[model samples]
Target: MSGGIHADTAPKPVGSYPHARRVGDLLLLSGIGPRIPGSDAIPGNRYDADGRLLHYDIVAQCHSVFANVRAVLEASGARWQDLVDVTVYLTDMAADFAAYNAVWQEYFPDPATAPCRTTLGITALPTPIAIELKCIAATGAGARR
Candidate 1:
């Protein structure tokens, strides 16, 4: 629903789906990566000459992905504070967990107000990005569309 919600300011979805969809007061966002808008460039990710990822900064990816999530939420007529739950996926948990957690605390400093979170260490993602976020936000019913 929500008329195939799309955030023009955010990076394009890797697949054939809208940025988000609304069901009742909940807005469900698709997987959001740390790619730069328009170029799909992953922040802090260094690629080799053959386009293979050489290394990445988890802090940069964390900030970028969070910003991307905010864009989707705001474009969907919601705010960052409206987020109720988030599921994070990372390719290398053991290597990235501490840095990612530090970055997370920077954005969500208050545990009382921060959304419920679940982090999963996966094998890979569609792009070379190291992190991705799946979010659910609560929004009002009014759509100025």
Candidate 2:
């Protein structure tokens, strides 16, 4: 079954796109950020009077982003355990990867059941968020595969 999915519980996307799309036995999530729903607030953001980004909390962003992903997956009738792959982006990997990896350990404790992952260091995001997640979770027959 192939269809586009929208998660009302998830924060509205920054651009024109559905929350996720289901193709065959897979649910492919869009780039999910740490923006809080309804308010579209990014956690851990601190700015100066000039709106220049100052210090941001990678820990808060990590948890918030994971929550957003969970919202989308649950809305799309998928489970965190069903995730087969994930791609992550971080703006300051050199400075934040350790904290980020620590947070990752919290969500995904066991390597055996964890999804395959690839992470990349990027210059900046479209928004002020420090991290974003791209996820692929299994469904229907794919869950059995």
Candidate 3:
């Protein structure tokens, strides 16, 4: 078993974690924040569809949060189809539940490609960040091969 999938190149890690790591057949990713690439500032915590900030709407945060997930996967030379499992940690479950699912569907448009998932409600996260996603993906050269 090759048990390895190297990135084309590595990006600057966000915090105290590697961007992604390959173990055996699995590519494991750390939780990504709402910050976009090339910037340290995180995205809006809450905003409307039209880009108006909303104090109580967490839907906006969920979108950016998942976008960050996509960024990490792309940087690691994988796609959403390679994903086998996901673990989501949320600080505010009630506010984020609906937003999470709706935005998730947008990214994971195909039900067949959907990964097994576990979403947990927690009291707090690293920042006031409402959502964070960590994922496991099997690469073609490894298990998916």
RMSD, one per candidate, in order: 3.2, 1.3, 5.3
Off by over 4 Å in 3: 1-14, 46-57, 141-145
Across residues 44-140, which tens digit of lDDT does each residue of candidate 1 receive?
A: 9888899888899889889999999999988888899888899999999999999999998999899988889999999999999889999988776
Clashing pairs in 1: none
**TM-score for each predicted model, relative to the true structure:** 0.94, 0.95, 0.76
Candidate 1 global CA lDDT score: 0.89
In order of listing, the candidates' clash counts read 0, 0, 0
The C-alpha local distance difference test score for the whole of candidate 2 amounts to: 0.92
- What would the per-residue lDDT of candidate 2 be over residues 1-145, giving only the tens digit for each residue? 5667999999999898899999888899999999998876789999999999899999999999999999999999898888889999999999999999999999999988889999999999999999999999988764833
- What lDDT does the true structure give each of the candidates? 0.89, 0.92, 0.69
Tens-digit per-residue lDDT, 32-115, candidate 3: 656555654455546679955465346767777666666767877777678889998887788778878888888777777688
Model 2 error, position 95 (Å): 0.6
Worst 10 residues of 1 by lDDT: 136-145
Tell me the lDDT of model 2 at 69.
97
Better of 1 and 2 by TM-score: 2
